[model samples]
Target: MMRSILERASHWLALVCRVIAGVALIAMLGVTIVDVATRYLDRLSDGAVAVTLLGSVELVSYLMLCSLLAAMAANVEKSQVVVEAFSHGLSPGFKHRLQGVYLLGFAALGLILCLGLVDSAAAAARHGEVTQDLRLPMGPIYTTAAVLSLLLGVRALIHALLGALFGAEGEVSHGE
Candidate 1:
């Protein structure tokens, strides 16, 4: 199939998304480190101790987790994972089939997780659950994470279908 502009755009967007997620992950890690260090500093003015730091840590942690899901999806899309060790000896057709099966199972699992969390998150949203200090709505975080995971699942399902149809890795050269 000819690579359309949309496909090319998606490829580039995915790379950018991966980079953004990577940077977010790093920031989250750094924030967490600071939170931990300051908490144990044993030298803070009674009024200088702000509760927002704790909330910031929570926010960063949630962002980190969401970014991780995105990263996994991007990694899977790019065929970054090393799976050749066991399948190297298998014929290409057989290996492709195996990969399709694997991807399908992974997608199924992700769907299950999203389904399980939807109700609990909704309840939290309805009851106005919030962080102890910042009192920010936790519902949005839960909802966003669920949706992102679901999207990732859909992407995996598509990849699996593509792999089964075209062969593993989706690496067909038109000229060759």
Candidate 2:
């Protein structure tokens, strides 16, 4: 029952990350489209109007940052790049245990990243940092990144325990 709950929590975190990534991607696309369309508004309106997204680059930067960071949690298991050259003849159970250990290492790395991001966020908040073009406060962005990094760490840990310790991959994935 406990494993099931953790599995569900991991799954939900991934789902939420996916949604955040999608929204960030869409917002970036929208910003790009608007920037392009309004690039020559002064000429298009024959000097009657001058419109352009002044800080579009900065806006897109934050959006892309959020999208990439948000996707990290969801891609923990699916995006593991491995050679697997020496493990050709390994037993299924051994492979499961090996994967679990590898995931633990990933979790540790994620946690380290989370800690660094938290420090960075705190510094950004303390110093009143702002983006160059937009003049937007960076504390919120850094805070969001720190939170997502923590989520990646936790999801990786949960995936390691439930997916490998229980038996196989399907133990953590009962419905989807």
Model 2: per-residue Cα lDDT at residue 155: 80
For model 2 the TM-score comes to 0.87
**Which lDDT tens digits does candidate 2 get at residues 38-79?**
877767888687788899998998899889888988777665
Q: What residue pairs are clashing in model 2? A: none
Per-candidate clash tally = 0, 0
* Candidate 1 least-lDDT 10 residues: 167-176
Q: Give the TM-score of candidate 1.
A: 0.70
Please name the candidate that would achieve the greatest lDDT relative to the true structure: 2
**Model 1 misplaced regions, further than 4 Å:** 2-13, 16-20, 33-52, 77-86, 171-176
Off by over 4 Å in 2: 40-48, 82-84, 170-176
